[model samples]
Target: MGGRFQSLREPVFRQWFFSSVLSASGTMTQGVAVSVLVYRLTDSGIAVGWMTTCTFVPLFLFGSYAGALVDRIGPRRVLLVTQTLLATLSGLLAVLTATGAEQMWMLYAIAAISGTVSAADASARQVYVIDLVGADRVSNAVALNEIVVNGSRILGPAIGGAALGLWGVWACCALNAASFLPPLIVVLRHKTKTVTHPHTQKIGGLRYVWRNPTIRVCVLLAAASGMLFSLNVPLTPFTTAIFHLDGTGFGLMMATFGIGSLPGVLLAAAGPSRPSGLRVAVLAVATGVAILATAYAPTVTLAFVGVAVTGCASIWFISLANTLVQLESDPGMRGRVMAVWGMALPGFSVVTGPFIGWVGGVTDARLGFGVAGIAMILAAATGWRGLARPTARTPVTSGASRA
Candidate 1:
């Protein structure tokens, strides 16, 4: 298990990891603030869905191109610039709220901009981590990465909820704006020379992803999970409407998911660096079952428990897939491969977010859960062979060449 903590021993990773913790907390807080703000302002579930779509649709359209751009430019340069742009967007949001001039259209624009820039960071960071931590520790590093993310997931919402309850929506945006500073500064001061794997064009990224079965399957499965999770847009509204929960209750509910995810991440970090594809499939299936159960949970208490299990399965499945993809791909193509994932993974949100919100509006929120759960289960089943198939033990490439 000592291996699980190996990446932390590196000074650079330690710096980035700590910064991500603060950043994640602020981002989660902003997430809650944004959801509540939209719901309160419009009082329409569809509007909430639109907000979610605006936030992620850009990812679907720009993900592959952003990844290719990262490869062409460099993760360091890309992250520094994206962080600055996001911080500017968040600051503008704060101003809009402070001036009482915030509009639904303005929110949508910012969400789209934020999502577009964030997509680049999401794709590039995976590649960046490999350079920072080296290949042998990649699995452990990814798992540890989840721990920071999950840890923030655990605490960020509750804090966001508290901030929303006390300070109003602008506070969350302000915090997010401030949170970008550290990462931006860290990237600016970082000293290591990054190894670049330049891709000539964006079209090549799509073709490479299509030609590789393992990468292809991982992206598809990730998209399935991403769709189910995208229900996050409506989760706040559903809890308030059905469970009669206040802000604190909603925060607690979100935190409970972190409770489940924390252990799952640790288990992944502590286990074998290379977990089996069969294992990933099993976890995905379990996540599907958990989501289905959560949908029909008779009470809030049951729903919390179900969400916890769902959270656990979700993290393990996604993290394992990330490890496998990072391990399997040639480093030269990895940025593009992850970019394809960035594109496909959130592609579901463009449809699913609004669709689930509509379902939540027309019938019940649980119906949305049913739809997502069934979709995931079916996806896992159909892809089981591809996910479970054995593959050659490819050496982890360091961009130069694979052993």
Candidate 2:
């Protein structure tokens, strides 16, 4: 077990990891609350979808630039600024919701503001892990990070739901607002000698990603999967109409998805550090199958089971993709590469969020969800040819070699 978690040997990473888990749990709780709150306010899947769209629009727009910025100045400096801004945003959100000043537009505005900050924060966080743990433990560190993400899904949603039901949206938002403190303190107190790469300009990252076949495929795969992952946007409708549940039910439903990823995280943590195309292709198919199962499930219990399966498969797929991209890219170019990775992951949702919402609005949530499942399968099949080819491990340092 100790060997499995060798990354923890680094004191900086250890502190950052635990603090991040607390902050992430709060973020998850707030996320559940925000979804439920939007649904209650507007009572439309499309409205909830629009909220998601608002959040990712900034990520889509400025993600690449943010990555170059991180690479130039280093991730630690960027994280310090972004984290503080995010905390302030959360606080502002709590105030607005608490004072009954939250309109749909207000929520949208807040989400957009946070998303803007996250454009830089997300890449900073991704690359900062490498800084803390070094390249050797990158795979384990990334898996553990995924665990923080999915594990928070377990606690955050449950707490968010109960708080929303018992207290209100403000309380849930407040909890999330408070959650940022630990990570902020950790970032403030921690110090590292981050090397700045002057040559890592904005477009350089894009060119690097475009030239690298493995990374190119990874970006494409991440973007394709984004459509299916946007299922979170319509989860409110799924809880209310499909499952006939309230806010608490919605929280549990989200929690089920988070809980399901535990097995996948364990598998990835124990698995190889170097990523394989075949492994990624298989996980993508499994995720699609799991999503389809959840979509067609007749009973809520069965739906939860299917959701759990999807969560497990999806986490494994994403963890592998993240590791592959991070490992394959040059250290100096990592931020830019991960920035594009972020764009593919959550940033691409700017398009899919609205589309999924529209689909659920016009048709049924199940059908819309089924469409995502179909998209995932098609994407995997399309990318299979490129992904199936074995990528030889070589010390790829610069733009000199396109291999």
Candidate 3:
């Protein structure tokens, strides 16, 4: 197998990869449509913030336990259950929307339900990457997955925007509900055996993360950088208010961000397999600056340019951090560790998402962007030392790494 795209050479992984792209496309489309729907219904940034909070609350609450669960029973089982629940929830949302049920409470309810399943699904999916491609090609596999995520960002929003213009929000929701089938079918067809970890010591995933310096830094910085990364909340108002654009323009704005991420992902895939702390820090700072620039961008073109740069930097930072944590973790504990990663990044969004939204609501989306930018810069400045620290060879570290 070739080095850069070696993960794709695995037949199972290849199939899983394509299936995930199809699934993620619908997921991404629904996400954009939902945001637009919320804005259209309430016209409030605070409402958008609350929707984000609802979506992430489950991850914030149960992410670590979800990871431990994945490690205990294996990712395959967890994915099977979660995906089924997600498909049901998407279908439910579609039904409600079709019936003219655009109430805030209803949207929040569905988001909470979907978020709950995602708490496990996200962790399982990360572990599933290792399961499909093995540990050796984990970095390459992760990079490819990032492409799927960001690539879907491009495709989903464009399709969603068009769908919204033509068939309405219900169509996007229905599309998402249907989109779950391909991945479910793929999971059903893929025959990876379950391997449970029954004898491992009872260490909490958070505690383990605290003990590992490299992972600890990666997670903490991820938490700190999350506020800046919650672009969707502010982007809602930024697109409509600043750009004065409709659904298509909003979709294009998001698609441009995804577009920028591809080159960065490809570049990372071509580089050394190992992740670098310096690169993470640099990208964090760059992400902040780009976001700040976008906040102040006077024209629509400049705002698009700014977000594209922010997307490239932000995704690069996240991908590197993910690779670092995965490579540093023990095979037995990888799921739990990644769960912590999930918490630090997405779970933390519960707080940042609302706050950013409120800022956009009260002041301006530009000011919200400024706040995120400053916070990111400060996080990188303070966390750089810890992030740059080399892994020490303590007994705990040695034992855990070799586990």
Candidate 4:
């Protein structure tokens, strides 16, 4: 165990670990704060759905462009600007809520702006990890990042729930917003570094992805899997509707999922260095199966257990898929490739949010969960061949060769 632990002690991994811890905690807190605030103000399921959509829609719309920008300007500078903007946005939201002057539209507008920044920020962050750790340890680094992020998923919601109960949503938002300061400060203190990439023909990142068969398949898989995974967003409302629960119940459910994800992260971290695409495909399929089982869970306890398994499988698939993308992409186009990945990851949710909500609105929330699971299973099964094949090499320019 000690030897295993020591292997993760590289400087780049250390930096990535710390950064992920701070950012993940902040993000989780922000999620709880936003959900509680919107639910309180509107008390409407659709409103909550829209709030979730607001966070994801920008990623879908602008993620590719953001990736291109990350490559052009470098990820370090991009992180500085986006993290600062996110912190400021959080503070503004805190003030609005604290003043009792908060309106629904104001929340919507703020969410949209924040979402735009997140798209770019996320792309830059993904590419930055490769630059920080180099390609060799990218898989381990990604798994460690997942561990941190999911760990936050465990801690942040618990803290947010307590804060929301004791101090109200305004205070939670204030604290959540302030959480970004640590990462921003950490980024600012680091010296600027150059990221080299191969100069490729300027094309939309999504277009570039479409041209690569393996990448294209992975992107499509990510999109379908993303939609399935996102059922949790709407699942909160479903739980409330069925169990007649409150914010605390929602928090507990998220916490349960978080708990389940921790072991998955560790497992992924401890797994083989080079993971095959088939492993990722299997994980995706397993995630869908877990969700399918959860849909039939008669008790909240059973549902929690089901979600926990789903969390484990989902994170494993995501971490592996992400690792594959980073490893296989040309460094020059890495930012764009990651952005394309990001776009597919979150973009589908934006379009599916209202649709899922409508599904819940029309029939039952479980139906939405069922549909999402089925879609993922079908997608994985269909794309199995592409995913199973080894990645093909593309011609690289001199700059890309160095990268």
- Which one is best on lDDT? 2
Question: lDDT score of model 2?
Answer: 0.82
TM-score: model 1 vs. ground truth: 0.86
Model 2 C-alpha lDDT per residue in residues 274-344, reported as the tens digit of each score: 87988988888888888888888999989989989888898888888888888888777888899999888
TM-score per candidate: 0.86, 0.85, 0.84, 0.86
Q: Report the lDDT of model 2 for residue 251.
A: 75
The TM-score that candidate 4 achieves is 0.86
User: Of the pair 3 and 4, which is ahead by TM-score?
Assistant: 4
How should the candidates be ordered by TM-score, best one leading? 1, 4, 2, 3
For model 1, the run of ten residues with the poorest summed lDDT: 394-403
Candidate 2 or 3, higher TM-score? 2
lDDT of each: 0.79, 0.82, 0.80, 0.76
lDDT (0-100) at residue 50 of candidate 1?
79
Residue 220 CA displacement from its true place in model 2, Å: 1.8
Model 4 local distance difference test score: 0.76
